[model samples]
Target: MDSNLYRLFGDRVRELRETRSVTQEELARRVQLSRASITNIEKGRQRVLLHQLIEIADALDAKPSELMPSPQSQSDPTMRRDVARVVEMLKSEKSRSDK
Candidate 1:
């Protein structure tokens, strides 16, 4: 949780939604998603899909990059842990295979 992308994502979505004078319900309707889904996105509880992000940006007349997390947050510490765990698993599998 380096820098907690949750805040960045939540703020960005709320800003974009407000700028367009769009309600969460309205945006949800336009995007064909549930209002709860839009709410989660604004709250940063859910990650948006690439295609859905693009569509949301288009609907808001914003650039898709506007929704992206910063480079630092993109390379999250959790991701490193996940990669290390996967590598360890692969090494164990190889060792088992060799025996």
Candidate 2:
């Protein structure tokens, strides 16, 4: 799939975020992400993982379904369940790619 699909998820993220009147820093703190990351997602520059989406939703008193692409449609099944592992792998991949 094209990255645009992830961009589509960004609007939902921004909506649930602003609906609660929470600051980006607060949301990022709750999710263990950087404010820049929250900005990126809200601006359609990065796609958040399922866990982060759920955390953000909870912080905003919303549902994960309220912040995600679709309840039935997700990024990847296994990666969705184990975000830490996937994040580490992605970091490793990035390091390797950057070399």
Colliding pairs, model 2: none
Off by over 4 Å in 2: 69-99
TM-scores, in order shown?
A: 0.62, 0.62
Question: After superposition on all CA atoms, what RMSD does each candidate show versus the true structure?
Answer: 11.5, 8.7
Candidate 2: tens digits of C-alpha lDDT, residues 2-53: 4754675677777777877888998899888999998898877886665566
Q: Give model 1's clash tally.
A: 0
Model 2 residue 2 lDDT? Answer: 48
Per-model CA lDDT versus the true structure: 0.68, 0.68
Clashes of each: 0, 0
> For residue 1, what is the lDDT in candidate 2?
56
In candidate 1, how many Å is residue 98 off?
52
lDDT of 1 by residue, 1-99 (tens): 434465566667778889889999988888899999888888778776545765676677776556555556665656545543554555456559879
